[model samples]
Target: MTPDLEKELDDFKLSHYENADFDSLTKKTIQLYNKFERLKDKKKQNRVVLDLYTLYLQATEILFINSHALSVTVDRFPSALFIDSFNLRNFISENFAKTTELSSWFFKLIFSVLKDNSGTNEKYNLYTNLIKEVAKDYLGDYDLLNAYKHGYRVKANHSQTTLSISVGNGQHFKLNDSDSTITYFSKETRDGVPIVLQHTLNFKIGRIFGKCLFVCSLLNNMRAIILLHYKKPVSSKDISSFYINDKDEWNSMFGGSHFKQPVFSLKGLNKKNAIPK
Candidate 1:
């Protein structure tokens, strides 16, 4: 946490003394703190308490950053922008380099960068082909988040409200959305794959910072496509030209020009669409 951030939040606690939402945040903070306070238990209670604490702290940080990131502008701190969920799209299009959600997975940034810096090449061609295939999978069309955690996703409808994930050891991995979670799993509730992934993920990151970093990585994947579009090298109108039928458009205006020249240009476009200054 930055010192300036601490001062600002402290000022917030002082000024908005009557706001219930801020009060709720404070009370939740205290309640969560106290849960971690007298943790005399050494088994399941300890783990549950710790995970809750971890979630609480990260969420608080998210709230804090959202309200302040743009305001804390400075010249010397380039690394700070890497975590900014706000200005991320700028990194993809310009020469500026920052870790963004879309390319959170390795090799994702390659296609966008290649298309921008160079005209279509073999590598860019392969990546563009792959991107079209992956784009269908990433539509995020409502049920996407609903189906992500569950093997069988709840079909999305306007009636569906919150997108929930299975917490805990994954014992009560029921799909009916009824049983909520009954503390730690006792091996009698679910005892299945959900528990497997939870436990496996636990083994990967055993500290607070590690877990938060893992979450940042997840943020990179969770909202990647929205990030991709904003960060794309060229404007969307340019993208249509690449997909227009090369053969069909070839004969219209620049007919017989294909054998003469195989490239697209604004002056050559028979239609008003493909022309760029």
Candidate 2:
């Protein structure tokens, strides 16, 4: 590549990173965190349920977008600019597995630099596991998200509601209540017996917001590593510095709860004879 063209490409790459607005994402996360805390103590149960569901969906989308940003930074792939959950899921899966040739190459390249700069296996594993957890949380809610996006099919079910169905041929299945915020049901068939797949997603409001903050921190950390790999200078005042220095404050504010996995059950077939009006 010619020197002038090379410099132009370099400038473009730097500009892209600068314009990602990760700082804004961090601020939004903090705002959502405060909102979640306040909403938890309110007396209106129905309104609170809707508010929490909205917040959880927003937080999850932010996490997915941040992961997409990180993937683009790692490989400088132009196609990654467009946000598609299907592609994002593949990227997350590939990175977590780190077995494919492309994933192995990039994974080693990125983490090797991280290891050198941080110089600790503990920190390395911590970040690695964080990525894995994020991937799991995102993929686990993929169907619920699609339900929201495609047709707004999810319903807010009251706490302690059980979904029981009778599949034909004497087979029956039930989904006991777990106090989830929203529930989604879809129809399917299993061995000639119809069944309804029930999907329930529950979130500890604080932890959901915490995962958003976690995504912001991971994005900045990986951005720095990617820039370093390309020999680009990272500023001392970068967003990563704040997260690294004030880890305790955010950790405390977000609390220590792990991400709750969404529940799925195949309840029995929808048959006119199965129910009494």
Candidate 3:
């Protein structure tokens, strides 16, 4: 980004912070955290956790967009006004890349926990299958995020009548005249007329980030449950290992035993037979 654009974005974000509803955001986060803590069913737990993870991802996207701006020139206006580019370079490289890896790992581990702990395979299959269904879309997101991981740049340039962002080698994203629509040009086109692309923001980065945020929230909830139920560490590997090492011990200690004196059962006892014989 140009120096002017960067400055403008900083100012814009600062303003947003000043006006943002921290109180509401805080309350909502706490409410979800508490709900996650008390959940007993694995499916419900996973769903809540996903919601939290998606929230964080969405928040990160908002932060990145708020922090960056693009300068666009117009035919009639004397100066270019700044607009958000919603670029994925910073969000992906700095934070969401690691998040994507961890979310996948966490999801698999949580599924394993459900499958292992449950008595019936049908219930586990029901929940895990749901995740698999929703997860198909996230798989596509992983593909897009993989492209940005290996050091990509997003820069915007403008002539008097047109403005575009240079996304990659021979890949330019231009704003369509109709509001926030974007267009793409690529090597396959060979300098042909630009192809009208769908909204890259909502489809690509936004969708992925939203899914990550959902997963993150559920992961946090799972962490809380593990801490409470197992008294174990929050690290995924550690939690799994601790459960493995301690499961037998828990069963031995808590499983079943008979008292020397019967307190509740009255079998083989009658009024006359009550006397020791």
Estimated TM-score for each candidate: 0.21, 0.56, 0.26
Task: Give per-candidate clash totals.
Answer: 0, 1, 11
Which candidate would rank higher by lDDT, 1 or 3? 3
Q: Kindly give the stretch of ten consecutive residues in candidate 1 with the minimal lDDT sum.
A: 253-262
lDDT of 3 by residue, 1-277 (tens): 6788766755553344344443343346556667866878755654554444344444434333322221122221112122222334433343333334433443454555442554444533433333342344332222223223332311111112223568658898864211111122111111432222211212222222223433333334343443434344444432221121344532322211111221233334577854231
Model 1 alpha-carbon drift over 4 Å, by segment: 1-20, 47-51, 61-65, 68-277
> Which stretches in model 2 have alpha-carbon errors above 4 Å?
1-8, 40-76, 97-119, 155-180, 185-197, 225-237, 241-277
Residues 1-277 of candidate 2 have per-residue lDDT tens digits of: 6778666766666666656666666676676556645654543443445444554455545545554555454344444556676776776666653423443343454455443455455555555555566566666655665566644566653344444568778876863323435666544456654455666565344445555666666456556665675777877545352123456643543211122332333344256545321
* Candidate with more favorable, higher TM-score: 1 or 2: 2
Candidate 1's displacement at residue 14, Å, is: 16
Question: Ranking by TM-score, best first?
Answer: 2, 3, 1
Candidate 1 clash total? 0
lDDT of 1 by residue, 71-116 (tens): 2433322244245533432322221122223333333432343235
Winning candidate number (TM-score): 2
Model 3 ranges off by over 4 Å: 1-15, 69-86, 90-277
C-alpha RMSD in Å of predicted model 1 compared with the true structure? 25.2
